[model samples]
Target: MDDTPTTTRPPRWLNDHEMRAWLGYRRMRALLDLQLARRLAADQGLSEPDYDVLTSLSDAEDHRIRLSELADRMLWSKSRLSHHVTRMQQRGLVTRQECASDGRGAFIVLTNHGMATLHAAAPDHVAAVREHFIDLLTEDQLRILGDLTDTVLAHLREQPA
Candidate 1:
């Protein structure tokens, strides 16, 4: 028997409108993330990941949460979260305590310094958002964009990696 690769059907490509929309979305996302990170770093001495981790901890009860739960909430890999946590710990922004019930696990607790930093950073972050994003959109546009975001996010979540 011959062992040969068989040809499949041609790939489905995005048409003009779809292509424009997809590319535009990609560009906007990339630029927005870059700008946000830059502004945060310049104005508050915080990176985007720092802000995310800090905010997650701040929102948790007692400003403390398990490391695994934080990783899941941040949508970050274990290794990624670990490294960031270590860096933040060095900066006096957070502390990790061994879990009493789980010897192998730990909890991330936001420190007073972290809370102070977040409180200082939040207003500037909000202003940046308004300047760069929210102010540019009308109320109707904001509502439609929000709905579109939710729809796309839900659909993406249903797909396999």
Candidate 2:
């Protein structure tokens, strides 16, 4: 006969509705990411990471931003960003300029080639977004989803990295 004493409470678990909702969200996120990456690669000859870097540069003022800032914006480590930037530089998509003020710092400037590539890719990328995501939802659903995303983003930002 076993005579072990237990004082632990059962763990709180998701109920049926919550479980369904959570699983749906996970499935949707995964599928959307995969589809978007595949579309970017197949249609634009750019990997999702490459597209991300290019878009970030395109959005920055003067089509340039400090290398550290770029890494922060992309949530990539310094080493990873540096390696990717090196690859891009080799392709003539971007150039690394030494910061005049800070000898140790560098700026990532999108080149004409990069700008042209982004311009060419933008139309198809927009179409893919519309086809796979935007058109799938009603206006009200889109608004609600945006609000939900903002809320979640706020919560996430409040947490420690």
Candidate 1 colliding pairs: none
Each model's Cα RMSD: 1.6, 3.7
Candidate 1 overall lDDT versus native: 0.94
Top candidate (TM-score): 1
The residue-by-residue lDDT of candidate 2 on 3-54, one tens digit each, is 9986898989999999998999999889988888888888877877788889
In model 1, what lDDT does residue 135 have? 97
Error of 1 at 142 (Å): 1.2
**Compared with the true structure, what per-residue lDDT tens digits does model 1 show for residues 122-147?**
99998998888899999999999999
Which residue segments of model 1 deviate by more than 4 Å?
Answer: 1-7
